[model samples]
Target: MEKVRVLVVDDSALVRKLLSAMLDSDPGIEVVGVAADPLIARDKIKQLNPDVLTLDVEMPRMDGLTFLENLMRLRPMPVVMVSSLTERGAEVTLRALEIGAVDFFTKPSSDLANCFAESAQEICAKVKMAARTRPRPYTQVQKIDVPPRLSADAVLPRSQSPGTRGSTRIIAVGASTGGTEAIRVLLEAMPPDAPPIVITQHIPAAFSGPFATRMNNCSAMRVCEARDGQPIQPGHAYIAPGGEHLLVMWDGAKHVCRLHDGPQVNRHKPSVDVLFRSTAASIGAAAIGVLLTGMGDDGARGLLEMRENGAPTLVQDEASSVVWGMPGAAWKLGAADEKLPLEDIAARLLVLAQQPIAGARRAAS
Candidate 1:
């Protein structure tokens, strides 16, 4: 198999060298060349014709976002962003994703060598994943082999099910890879009075707040990062904080958000499994589970559990997904009751939320 070719673009010489060496360490990846800035990168792109481009969020001559917009419009291709672990970096990275970058990786603040050593696997994986994205002539899709991981049971036990339907219906969502933009699109389409939404989108801790803020600006419904013990209500959407699991818990009278600090489940801190399983056990038929575009099978089992418990489930169709790993896994497991494109999911969710729950399970006595 031909290795995925990559071009590294960063204004920092150290970063470019580190990124190139890290990407090349993977046998499946080949770093074709590196450029100091967007102008040089522009010329190299025409010369190298690399399958993927790892772009620095902040550049010297032209900013990453401006270059990304120009690239997407002029010569669409798969691009991954490299961002610093800061508030401004998070904000800029989110904008890059909205501008059509495939995914992003946050650089550590200090201890560069050690941090890069630990993150090399993830960095290479994102580049490989980007290679298979749309606008790049589709080569064979790369398979990501995830090692054994903790399940939702690690955070919240499976035995604890929310046996009764709450007073209000809830919408539970999970996504990764291209999820930031996907979640934005879905939220923007939701009406102000739509059911309460709980989301887990596989992001680093620094990015979640900015992501929520960006979503709030575009979405009609109020959106904010989920707070521990926060009341669940309609006309609002709660985003799971990065590095924490967001679960819906029964508080005897009503459902509320519970943030759990625990081991990474399904190789993700805010694993979709945790959120979906929490919804399945707590909300039962009164909830709708939507698995949007993401890589890996994190949410498949939990979505299946939701279906078994009578909740309606939807997976984003492959054509509309940046990476169909999560949704495809759910489709294969027969977890989703319906598969819809990104464009149709919001309307369908609204419709499903209105359907009355009949014979829904009650809280265990």
Candidate 2:
């Protein structure tokens, strides 16, 4: 088996060394070279032709984002960002992903050595995943025709039935790996009056806020990071805050978002499984569960539980997934009620959300 070649680019000599050691420890990966700045990294890329690149957000000669933009435009390849756990770092890291970077890792603020020690396995796994990913180029700006934005009331016209504004019907979505772009694409096409949406995207705490803001800017529905006790409402989407667990719970007669800090479930805080299982327990048949592009089976069992409880489950098809691990696992486990391409998921979800509670129950039965 051929090993995945990697190039590590960081202004910090310690970080570059630590990253190289961590990656080289894995038998499947080979540290091809290390660069102190983007200018050096650019030359090393042409010279080494590595399969993956671990890039620092703040380099000396040139910033990571600018180099990433140029790289994607000129020679697109898998690039994973190594960023600090700060607000500014989060914002810039998200921009790198939008510019076509494959994934990211957040460096710990304290105890750098201990942090790298703990994260060795994850770093190796992500690099392996990145090697398999083929990042799409963002060279030219393309104009898309967006429909006139509709309010929640307009999106979900009140039916004469019992499933009205306070309806427990909701949408639960989960993703990782190529998920940011996948989620953006899914949400951008949705009507403003769509059902309440709760999402779990594998991200760090600092990045989630900026990610939600970016999503909101492009999407018709109001998008924000999930807050503890925030009321779940139609025409609004809630994203699970990084480093916390986001669960939907029944608060009196209405459902509300609940955020809590807990031990990592399936190696993820704000895990997809945690959110999906909560939706299954709380809303059951009234909920629609979607598992999008990701690298692992984190949400598969929970999606199965949702299906068992009578919720409709959709998985993005392999053809459209950046990595088909999550959705593919769900399909293999018989957790998915339908397997659809990325483009079809939003429309299908809208149709399902429009069904009255009783009608949805009947269909499930």
TM-score of 2: 0.89
Q: What lDDT does each candidate get?
A: 0.90, 0.85
Encode model 1's per-residue lDDT on 6-121: one tens digit a residue: 99998888887877777777888999999999999999999999999999989898999999999999999999999999999999999888888999998886777766767777
> Which ranges in model 1 have alpha carbons more than 4 Å from their true place?
136-148, 160-162, 361-365
> TM-score for model 1?
0.95
Reference-based TM-score of each model: 0.95, 0.89
Model 2 C-alpha lDDT per residue in residues 54-91, reported as the tens digit of each score: 99999777889999999999999999999999989988
Q: How far does residue 213 in candidate 2 sit from its true spot (Å)? A: 1.5
